[model samples]
Target: MTEPNLPSGNDTDTNSSAIPGTAAAWERATLERLAMATLIEQRQARRWRNGIRIAWLVFVAAVAWFGWERGAAPADVSKPHTAVIEIKGEIAAGGDASAEQVVSSMRSAFEDSGTQAVVLLINSPGGSPVQAGIINDEIHRLKAKYHKPVYAVVEEMCASAAYYIASGADKIFVDKASIVGSIGVLMDGFGFTGLMDKLGVERRLMTAGENKGFLDPFSPQTEKQRAYAQTMLDQIHQQFIGVVKAGRGNRLKETPETFSGLFWTGQQAVEMGLVDQLGNLDYVAREVVKAEELVDYTRRDNVAERLVKRFGASIGEGSVHALKLAPSLR
Candidate 1:
């Protein structure tokens, strides 16, 4: 009687319930995975759409800027006018008033048949002497070849390297109150040896040549190195003096303070023979050149160059930071 007994109803019901629960769990998990995959795909699609829109906007902006720059070329040069070239801001190798820009503009002005004369509109606190020297030499050469009188019209301030280039002009005109002159050469730097000593820091610099690290700020500068630097500066000063003397000739009223690296008012400069007269661009064009119309021929950085420079500024900044560890000229 005991062997013939079957399974209980409760056991059968529990087994059947367990099988449906497991299957339901598996189906729910699969549905969840499918929903998550759809969400991920939607997010990726949205990102791609945003990226494309941004790229299209940038492309359109670049094209429009380029077109505007190209269409902004100067008008015809074959018209009677006074050719004006601006020498404004710092005179450096890659600046707006650099030797290359100024020289190129001068050539264009001088070659034009209708150009009555070339005028330099200078406004600067001065910069690199090497750049100034190149421009000064080019001025003399162009004048000799073209036989066109080149005049310098000063506004606001013109000192140091700016005056260096102006010296080559046939005549320099300045406003009565304009600042002028700074006839000298300089090599400025700083020393941190005492500070480093106080901080208990050591500079372990290695060089093949004995004087290779002479200009290093953290290291102590020897008397011999100082003398060598002074000699170099003196030679450059003499060269600058010679250029001014040759340019001004008998007109310059030489005095002890003339080449002492001092600046003066435009009125005082006129009295000292450093400037010709009190005038302006309009006055020079109308009275001197007898050409009323002024035509500008200044070369400037184009739209594309400016954009490239702006984007590459971070790279340039990193290079400058590295260069700061080494000695350099101003």
Candidate 2:
């Protein structure tokens, strides 16, 4: 069939100036062209949107698959397979190495249908007492509930709060030279009363209660305040002793030297019954759990979080550097 071609606006008849058919044809063609242009724009927009949507979906699927693989890989390939989770920083609340991370990692390791055992690789000197206690309790709960062996393998240093956490494990392992055991609580601050006196400076601290300013470092500590602080420390110390005893069971040697707030090599620790075995992470993974592979369930940083952390850390470093470089006159 031949395509329709309407008369143009300039195609007026020479004999009759008024040609109704030609005018109608021009009007129809004009309307059709306008409609065609509108349709083309809509179609182009739909194509562009569809292309963008497809590209985004592909990107998401790729990222999701990568993450799933990381989390889904066989935790262990051996008959008594196990999952290993690492805790290698300060154990303060809200930080990246808090009790929250430890609990979440442990939960993931044990709750997984594939994980036959759970191992914690700890390499920390320790942090906040409250955070440590929370992690310890979480470990105990998970261990009892899942009926899976939970082991603590100390790498470099596991002291104080780290030791608190280790005491929850079914068995603890340490390297030959790894630092172990600082079963003590500590709080340190400065006392500048003499300096303030010599410099004619006043603390000017006003408190509602007399004991409220007990820990003010700039002022002299009264005997009453000192006694109170020591009592608090004693209570926490006793609690630490109890946890250590529970974890070590009848193997622990009860003596003043054991809880002397000192750290020793892993070899010394094994003799003192602080750790069950003297070995590194791999030794326990193969010999105890009999697992030849490791699958980490800890969530990786998202793009936004990574960018924010990177920029924030850079800015903080620059600020610290600037402060350090500033002139300090005596």
Candidate 3:
């Protein structure tokens, strides 16, 4: 019959090739779609990351602005009030109770006509003598300039440098149980030479001057160095004694153990003239100052400043201060 209309070999081969070609084209299209999807997802993720970063920056900026405005707001000076300046914690440079902060607050209080009197709200274990001296000097200067009396209201403990600052006040009020008076200078450190010898650990320290490394804790301390340090302590102690004597005048009851780095309870302090009386902030403001309304003028670190210090701005400086084996008023 004409072998019928049987398919030729060429037709069969063409049809099979067409089927394979179609599969290959399908795979390419599928791969292209997958790639496009991946690109879109990556783009979305990048946008989200950017958005989060921006939000964080905005939040930080808002906090900074609010802190600034709060600090910059002017104090209400319409009525008579007792202007209070806080001296809490360690008194050191770049600290909350630093000379800069205390002095600035003092100046503000003294300059304000509405301020009936200035009160130093002190509660510290003491710190740098230099900072304390600055605040003390400013207390005298501000009192002389404005003819305003400055009183000290002690809470908890006020010793060493805190006592030094309080010495400049007209009167010091304290709680009956408050610990007061460690009126001395000390340079405390541990000599690791013996420990290192036991452990066979050698310390290699380089310095340009012999005295530069004298305070090095890992090295040995010589007799001469010890004497030198003691002499320094004596000199600083004399200065502290002089300040206390001048400030306390006839009010202070002199005793052998008064400046011997000894501490006493607030009751004992009052008996010894180290404290004026047993009282509190409210008592001082109402009775002593004759102004019941109290106004705080303490200059503390704002949020932006604290953030800067918290980040990395003053971290190295703080570490250096911590690592120092130098003299202190405590």
Candidate 4:
């Protein structure tokens, strides 16, 4: 007997394809998924691009703002005012109290027709003597040229090189408790020879000249080198003494301890004729300058200056340290 006629493979396929809507629905779902995935990836990429663009714009705006602020003068000089310049921090070569910044501020103040006098608002422990010397010389020159009195107003502590600059002022005003002097120069460094011995490390230093590595802390200092250093310090000390004498004139009460690199209270400074008076900035502006209006002409580092300095420091980090022969007043 013949078995009942079952559906052939071709007949089954035809039956499945007869449902056209089911096949079309499956294809539509796959296409929709692919489209959604593509849209998501595009959105993420766009967000990243926008974020970078916004960051770039912000950076450019900040740079421009800093540039404008640094280049712009303090204020308009249409009326009489007291021009104030601040000397606050270590007086180093590229510091806030650098000679370049101080001199530029002084020039601006002296050149202004509406400025009655220039005031140096000082709050520092002091730094490089060379920087201080430049500022001191410029102060004298500006005073001579403009015939305007320059006063020094000490805030907290004005010692060493700070005092050196203050001495150039026509009058020095200080608070009663202010630290006022440290009239000396010194070169300080750490001797790592003992540490190196303990660590069993040898220093490999090569120099063309015999004295090139004279003050290297890793090496033993010779007697001749010590004497040479002392001689140099003595010369600088004599130069410092001369400048103090010239600046203070008869106002200074000459004594052995005056230039002994000792700091004193403001009251003692006044008694020793180191400080002219016990007063503040307001007192000087209102009473001394006779113009209550105050204008700050201090040259300070703006954003651009700070960025440049940081960049330079980063680039020079791998360089060898130079021997500092110039005396520091810290």
Candidate 5:
């Protein structure tokens, strides 16, 4: 076998050389497949990123549109129109019916040359005497400066500070069945001291000033503090009474029960001289203002404003909680 080179042996060598070529080809194919897979994954990731970007743009555009729509004036400013300012819901500092919003709206309405009159559409259970006072003061000032009549049209209800605000108007219009009047001031809270005593829990309150924790619900309130609080409430109530008297003038029918925190129907309010006449917003716009085209100049919170306010309130509340302070009054 050694003497002559066998063809069969040569064939075995050839087969051995072909084996490496076949393995190299297989490796190249595998590498190509891996590269293709990587390319597909990259394309998919890019598509996802593009989609996310597009979605974010759409969201931003929608928000911008919504904000514009919410804040834009509905009617043309060139024609004579009844400028309507809404005072709805709780009239708190950060609310839609806040003093800042109402006052600003009134100022704009009064400043407009095309405005015939300003109308306050009031529908609230009332809140914050301070807010109401600011609005009332602005109404009087604007009325004096602009020489334009300001009328209040009561909807379902107008009580407490709501009535305080309404009284500033030149005249108050109301529906016969609408609820009105709650001319009073009060500071309301609950005593948790008794509950804590029953539960065997002691209150740990620390204050820099002697009367700093005067109204703390967890602590026991002394008779002196109670009397002081009552005196303060009485003073505020007197101030409220003065405003109502001044606003209504001799038109108001003085009665002992009138300022007793009692609410009455609009018909009863008219009888008591708390309201001028039974009428609605449309009636006031058409008959009183002589302008059927109503334009709203009410200052309202847009999406961004509302978000900022909510965020600020949350931060303030958190800080107050961390300081272990009771909720503050307006």
Candidate 6:
């Protein structure tokens, strides 16, 4: 009876009980692995979502910045009121320092509503009379159109035609170290008649008019030619004097020699009535315009455009510098 009662502890029933325990352990391990895999998936999903959100935010910010910069929108008048327009370099027909560029800048300055006044920062030796005239006329037009006061500031040097452009301003300012008042016209060339004679060179020029070859290097100048040239220069000089007088009004104290193509220091210019005030641009803006904030309505150049202009300027400066460095026989 005892033998047949039940299997012992090492019997099949006991082993079967151990099998269920092992199966339960395996199931627990499987469930733990599943939980770890789920946790990893969730973490990866959250990280991916955060990364996508950050990328989207960056894209939106870039778009907004570029839009504000490049879009055709209204002027941002968050700061000062007066607009500054620079008239730098030579006033020529085709150059960065050209009448057209100056005139365009003036026009844009007046066009902007935020521009309460204008400051023309002039630093030039001179170039073309016609170009200067165009700039002067545009300045006049803009001043009258906007009913805004225009102040001209001479930086280092404002000579000849450069002064012509500045003369149109309501008030001219100059610093103590600045040079002003080179109020005349010049056309220069060398006559090589003697050199050509020594070199056995013959003159071979065809002209229908007798005066066409008047200042030819190979020909000798006549009394009439000299007289005619003087008359022309005189006429141009008188025109310059008249314009300066008109623009400066009762402020100018002119003698026969004031407009005789003479330059003066800024201090001397103030004493001689060539400049209205002996002050810099900041002084003028602070006193006359009565504002510390200034706006430069100058159209900003893009990266590519700036690079091109600088490249051209560099090439120009390099060539001129190279020529100057070249040795000369004389």
List the global CA lDDT of all models: 0.90, 0.81, 0.90, 0.89, 0.90, 0.80
Q: Please state the error at residue 51 of candidate 1 in Å.
A: 5.5
Candidate 5 lDDT, 168-266, residue by residue in tens = 988999999999998999899989999999999999977777888988899999999999999999999999999999999989997998999999999
lDDT of 2 by residue, 1-330 (tens): 997897665774543666776899999999999999999999999999999899668656655654433243353434345687777888887676688867777787777777777888889989888898898899889878988988899999999999998988988999899999888988789899999999999998766777777777887899988898989999999998988898889988767878878988999889988988887777887888787566665544555445456656876997888887564331
- Candidate 5 Cα errors over 4 Å, as ranges: 1-75, 308-330
Pairs clashing within candidate 3 = none
Candidate 4: where are CA atoms >4 Å away? 1-58, 71-75, 311-330
lDDT (C-alpha) at residue 39 in model 3: 100
Q: How far off is residue 216 in model 3, in Å?
A: 0.9
Flag clash pairs in model 1.
none
How well is each residue in 107-190 modelled by candidate 4, as lDDT tens digits? 988999999999999999999989999999999999999999999999999999998899899999999999988999898887
Candidate 1 vs. true structure, TM-score: 0.80
Best by TM-score: 1
Clashes of each: 0, 0, 0, 0, 0, 1
C-alpha lDDT (0 to 100) for residue 306 of candidate 2: 52
In candidate 5, what residue range of length 10 has the lowest lDDT sum?
A: 66-75
Question: TM-score: which is higher, 2 or 6?
Answer: 2
Model 3 agreement with the true structure over 1-330: per-residue lDDT tens digits: 566888999999998899899999999999999999999999999999999899769758966675654252156776899999899999999888999989988988888889999999999999999999999999999899999999999999999999999999999999999999999999998888999999999999767668788888999989999999999999999999999999999999999999999999999999999989999999999998899988888887776766656655555878778867654422
Q: Estimate each model's TM-score.
A: 0.80, 0.70, 0.79, 0.77, 0.77, 0.68
Instruction: Spell out the clash pairs found in candidate 5.
Output: none
TM value for model 2: 0.70
Candidate 6 to native Cα RMSD, angstroms: 19.8
lDDT assessment of candidate 6: 0.80
